[model samples]
Target: MEKSIHKDQVERFGSILLEIGSLLMSYGANSMRIRVTLNRIAKAFGYNLELLITHRALMLHIDDKDDQHSFNQLKRTSPHGVNFRLVSGISNMSWRIVSEKWSLDEIEKEIERLKSLPHYPRIIILLLVSLADLSFCRLFGGGMIEMSIAFGATFVGLFVRQEAVKKTFNPYICIFFASLASSLISGLAVKFNLGDHPEYAFATSVLYLIPGVPLVNSFSDIIDGNIMNGIVRGMHGMVIVLSIALGLALSLLIYQI
Candidate 1:
């Protein structure tokens, strides 16, 4: 294991480690992945490190051998949307650091590049969502005309969600609005007798808004013993579901269909 020559260098390394942790957290990495990545990075840099991770914060301690100095870093982070691309990049970077032993500057530059990497276009996401909802409708035995209505309604609903996200609206409000818009459209179709069992489309239209990742991650975290983060993530999913249900109820009341 390498040893740090200076206390200043140890402090800088700890700060950089904290920066990586914060970025991972903000990008919606689960506790397990974050802990593993940080450990790998510390091992690569020849430090004895420990991490205390939670949904709201990350605490890290790094001990450098040469100077027998320890540095601590803590960063508070808010949950963000999951981006598998970011997760994959970070995972790859962690291993690369171990194998290549890159300097801090090089790693920092690469991290910046990864941070700025563009996600898939919104239009593409919208189209895929529409397709998925359409598939859901079909799998649930929706016929041709009902499927058509579902596709259009889900497309619009997802577009509303996309817009809400772009505007950085409160997540509950965004889900509520999206669900309301989708359900309203579906209710209107049912009112007009647009297809056989328009209710199916209406009911399943907002399934796309379900916080699938959070719910699954909650279970994953709990299984891995990060109980607090698991509960927090589960609560987020629960609130989103409740918001969706509220939106649907309001739409049904207002449309009376």
Candidate 2:
């Protein structure tokens, strides 16, 4: 009730705020960060906001200074993969909205640009993951043959995981299959006595399946006082690790090696 804001614009304001919230949540910003950032951005435009934040959905209520116009929105999000780049980008955008005093049109345009941003290429990830496992093989006192096998195993597993992501498979299923493929391939080293240490390849190849990001985020959330969100994220990360274990165990069972 401080000042008048146009009633007709309420819907548009709500829509834009909803878009921002949905994207932040989807990109893996912790709930507290998302809530605080969204509230600040709305207030920058002379609005008051309330958010009912959970891990899966963001429910929002916005009221302008006049208190006459209000809007409510519920945005449901699917299980989103971790994208730290996108999360940082969204956080920066929220700050710029306040510092730069961007108008609605400019904000909307910027949001569209952010939404359309491309993820890092799958091929690049495949290469890097392979290289990392190859390094781990060497670190484990493996010979050249073990390193090569680890590289190939990681590459094939990561490729499967990337394809599964593209096809929108369940995360648990993707982790399971990826771990299975990598461990199974690495098992070849032992089957044929292809290396001084075939076991190193087997151990390292599926290291890519560790849900490190989620686990880290879970601890961060917990320390930040969002205990429920932290626990949920922790459980989710633990489940992924368990899936990786299941897949590896299944592979070992099949080979009995």
Candidate 3:
């Protein structure tokens, strides 16, 4: 928002700022972090920012110090997901912007690059998450047999979740299906007496779908005084919990346990 810059340039800058904020919000960043990051970038570019953040959208206003040139935009964010790499990358890029003074084009290109960065291979993630659930089962007093059951159940459940997400299913429905798959698999222990701690295996199998990030972020948002956003995120997490509970209940009914 420098006085020398044309209104068109200011508009473009505003658009980029909105894009960055939307990306952060969609990638599971807390409201405070998104606001702070956008403000940091705007300040570095000699502008002031006012932001309205929500779970599914972002609205921003930008103006020069003298209020000569101004821009306002509202953008709908992408479906919420967790990608800490993108969030941290953008935070670092903002600091770099402050020091190196990048052009809008350069910043746009960097964001694109970050978007294209590949996630960890799916098989690797599957193994790791399943291992983590197995560890959780053991920690919950499950024997080795229960841990093995948990590992297999989590692997299948997480795979279903990945495929459902790729198909663009509703998030809650996807979680429901994943929890159902996991609990159904773990429920086998009860049907066949394969493990001594079948209850532990069953309970821990769906732990992978607990919506931990959203719950934690919601708490952080509330603590930081973003009340509405916090409530929305918390509700989102609660719906996921409900979906999981329904899945578990169905499994229990099927097993009559």
Q: Of the candidates shown, which would achieve the greatest lDDT relative to the real structure? A: 3
Instruction: List, residue by residue over 73-150, the lDDT tens digit for candidate 1.
Output: 788877677777877898899999999998999888888988899988878888888888888888888888777777
The model with the greater TM-score, 1 or 2, is 1
**Number of the predicted model whose TM-score against the real structure is largest:** 3
Please state the error at residue 84 of candidate 3 in Å: 0.6
Question: What is the C-alpha RMSD, rounded to one decimal, of candidate 2?
Answer: 2.5
Lowest-scoring 10 consecutive residues by lDDT in candidate 1? 1-10
- Candidate 2 lDDT, 1-257, residue by residue in tens: 43244665777888888888888777777777888888888889889999877778889999878887899889897678777777787789889989999888998888878777897787888898899999988988988988999999999999998888789889899989999999999987777778677888899999988888778879988998889889988999999999999998998898888
For candidate 1, the C-alpha RMSD (Å) to the true structure equals 2.4
Can you tell me which runs of candidate 3 are displaced by over 4 Å?
Answer: 1-5
What are the root-mean-square deviations of the candidates from the true structure over C-alphas?
Answer: 2.4, 2.5, 1.7
Clashing pairs in 3: none
TM-scores, one per candidate: 0.93, 0.91, 0.97
- Clash counts for the predictions, in order: 0, 0, 0
lDDT for each candidate structure:
0.85, 0.85, 0.93
- Which residue pairs does candidate 1 place in steric collision? none
Candidate 3 per-residue lDDT over residues 104-168, each given as its tens digit: 99999999999988999999999999999999999999999999999999999999999999899
Task: Write down the worst ten-residue block by lDDT for model 2.
Answer: 1-10
Sort by TM-score, top down from the best = 3, 1, 2
